[model samples]
Target: MIHLQFRKVHGNEGESEAPKRSAAARKSIGLKAKAERFASRNGSRSPGKSPKGRVPKRTARLESDRTSVASAIAGTRSTAPPRPRSKHFANAVRAYEAAIKLMHAEDFGRAIRSFEDLIAEHSEEPEIQERAKVLIHACEKKLHENER
Candidate 1:
């Protein structure tokens, strides 16, 4: 009978199929360690200020102040809903009229698209909805006529 024995090495004892670290991993680790050491020595000074003197105000605070100043300059809070139209239905009427004109002109493609836009934007307007349906039918008739 023959007896075989194995002795465990210190670094390779438990590493059966562990992958080796790539060069990129080693570089990243070195950079992170250097950054940590630099931060520790600097002790919370603003990024470009001298470490021997008092730290300056943070650039992040300046950014927030600028944003508030910009909002003041714009003269209104951003919470307002967007304007529906210059006169709150005038623009929709204009678009609806344009669609009707296109339908009358036998420009079925643009007419259909315009009517679809009006219906999407102002579906609650009964007049516009009715007009859109009529214009759609007219556009279909014009398209069929053109195909013939």
Candidate 2:
């Protein structure tokens, strides 16, 4: 009776049932287990294991590429062209001349203030920068003498 029941069960098998899972699914499951184990051992989401828990070679290569792009952007920003000066050379020269005139008239305070304004306005000019420094020293000397 048991053999007859086994024959009856085996006789009704059909070809249209769900197909068995392919080898790829089994490999994927194995890979998933390996990935979980790797994540657990490293305490972080490291790509793969190395001798020192270093990132995988492919991930390191990507990191290097990102660094290179960052460096290139920085270089481009630094090498960008400077804008044209708003205050022309003639205007800066006139301002310097006016400050000198005020200094010669013994208005040391006003002259020093004008020189500071000129310096702030034309910081790119070497002559104005030097003159500003000299006028600052003169103003300091005059202030010291007036304090006596």
Candidate 3:
């Protein structure tokens, strides 16, 4: 069923609701409409929308040694959604990041200690442990240069 309402126009004729508004009002309406359309389209294609027999990129990435510091630094990464991480793994990452931050801040002594702690605490994380070993050497060299 359809209902039609007829309004008598006093001055302007054949004008749409879109055109009747001021320029800013029209612009706002256009943007809002565009955003709504985009959201609807994006929702249909979102990662979890079809998650059957699929390993999310995050977990699958960690399954290989390819998930290393070098790849992260190069920004050679995927755009897929991340799988949830274990508490232990999350803690390990936090510790590693903290050490890296200290290294970036040029606090080599503390960074060395922190990286060593990460290696000790997260030995199950071979990728992290290997990277930490390499970074420890870099920190050692930096300390040596400073002492000279």
What are the models' TM-scores? 0.40, 0.40, 0.43
Candidates 1 and 2: which is better by TM-score? 2
Query: For residues 85-124, what per-residue lDDT tens digits would candidate 2 score against the true structure?
Result: 5558778988999999998888898889989998888877
Q: Residue by residue across 1-148, what tens digits does model 1's lDDT show?
A: 0111222334555455555579999799888778878878987544665655467768999999999999897886556786465453787889888987887787899999999988888866777788788878878887998899
Best by lDDT: 3
| 81 Cα displacement, candidate 2 (Å) | 22
Kindly report which residue stretches of model 1 are placed more than 4 angstroms away from their true locations once superposed. 1-86
lDDT of 3 by residue, 51-130 (tens): 66685567666655565767686687667787576899889999999999999999999999999999999988888899
Query: What clash pairs does model 2 have?
Result: none
Q: What is the C-alpha RMSD of each candidate to the true structure, in Å?
A: 13.5, 19.1, 17.3
Off by over 4 Å in 3: 1-84
Using TM-score as the measure, name the better of candidate 1 and candidate 3.
3
Once fitted onto the true fold, the runs of candidate 2 whose alpha carbons sit more than 4 angstroms away are 1-87
The TM-score obtained by model 1 is 0.40
| By lDDT: ranked, best first | 3, 2, 1
